[model samples]
Target: MAIKIYGSFRSPFVMAVALAVYEKEQEFELLMMNIKSPEYMNNFNPFGKIPSYQDEDITLFESRAIMRYVATKFEGQGAPLLGSTFSEQALCNQWLEVNGHSFTPAIVEMAFSKADTESSKLAFEKFEKVLDVYEARLSVSKYLAGDSYTLADLAHTPLFHIFMAVSDDEKKKCLTSRPHLHAWIQDISSRPAWKKVTERPENTFYKPRTESQ
Candidate 1:
């Protein structure tokens, strides 16, 4: 059977996994499941998450783990996503952890929290600090993990896409004001695989809400 991904594009985690598959020159069938159902919980994810992956070899949950598996399984197929050197690999893993722990929380909070609220203000502050770290790191390197685009960079594309779509210009200045972070976002978001993800019909939900809208 073809690699099957049980989730919807409504979850950026799911899209990130799909992007990883594409980067590895692989294709998968996107499926949906009642995450709370016993069958899904028992066979796929005990935690009941939207994205669950199954292939001939393994069944998996957690988007980052799935992406890591895809990258390793297809290491020789397409873009070298694990980085070229030992140091780069180490940095790749480090930044992947950063993406998970440091970056994701703040962005999610900022995206979902209502504007002009204390919670929103706190989220923005935290997110700005994280972006400051990225700007400093990206200013000297071409990609997050190193010179090559690694899973670290790939992990961020979907989140940034969602953020850009939902944020107003005033809010977006948090990203745009940081020249390096803005440039890195442009570079990663422009990838053909990401373009393919965006073009999928299932990805119709996160349209940018501009001032006019």
Candidate 2:
């Protein structure tokens, strides 16, 4: 059976999974459904969240887990997303955790919080601290897991795309002010796999706001 993904492309989590599949040189059918429906909840994701994945051997939810599976299952086809060495692999896993726990939460806050509110202020502060750590780490390493591209780097591309699209010039300084972090974002966002994900017609939901509109 062919691979199938259930979710809206507007979700960064869904897009992240798509990016991973493309990086592995695999194609999938993108499906949409009522996630809260009993059939979907019971079969795909019990939590009623988006971005569930299915293939011949398994049904899986959670974008990160699905991404790891794609990387492993198609290990020889396209981009080597698992990192080249033992140490690099370990680092890749570590950074993947950091992306979920540290980076993602802060970016989500910054993306959704109302401007000038205490919550927005706090989110920016938290985001800047996380970026400080990223700047320090990326200053020396070419990618999050090391010198090579890995799932660690792939996971952040979609989130950053959304964040960059929604954020204004001032808010963008959180990334642009940090040279290493800025450069890293530019590099990862430029990959063909990611470009493919962004170019899909379904990706039209998160467009940047123009002054006139």
Checking candidate 1 for backbone clashes, the offending pairs are: none
Question: Which parts of model 1 are misplaced by more than 4 Å?
Answer: 209-213
Each model's number of backbone clashes? 0, 0
Error of 1 at 6 (Å): 0.7
Q: What is the TM-score (0 to 1) of candidate 2?
A: 0.96
Local accuracy of candidate 2 as per-residue lDDT tens digits, 7-65: 99889999999999998888889999999999999999999999999999999999999
Report lDDT (Cα) of residue 88, candidate 2.
98
For model 1, what is the alpha-carbon lDDT of residue 193?
A: 91
Tens digit of lDDT per residue, candidate 1, span 10-77? 89999999999999888889999899999999999999997899999999999989988999999999
Worst 10 residues of 2 by lDDT: 204-213
Task: Estimate the TM-score of every prediction.
Answer: 0.96, 0.96
Candidate 2: lDDT of 97? 99
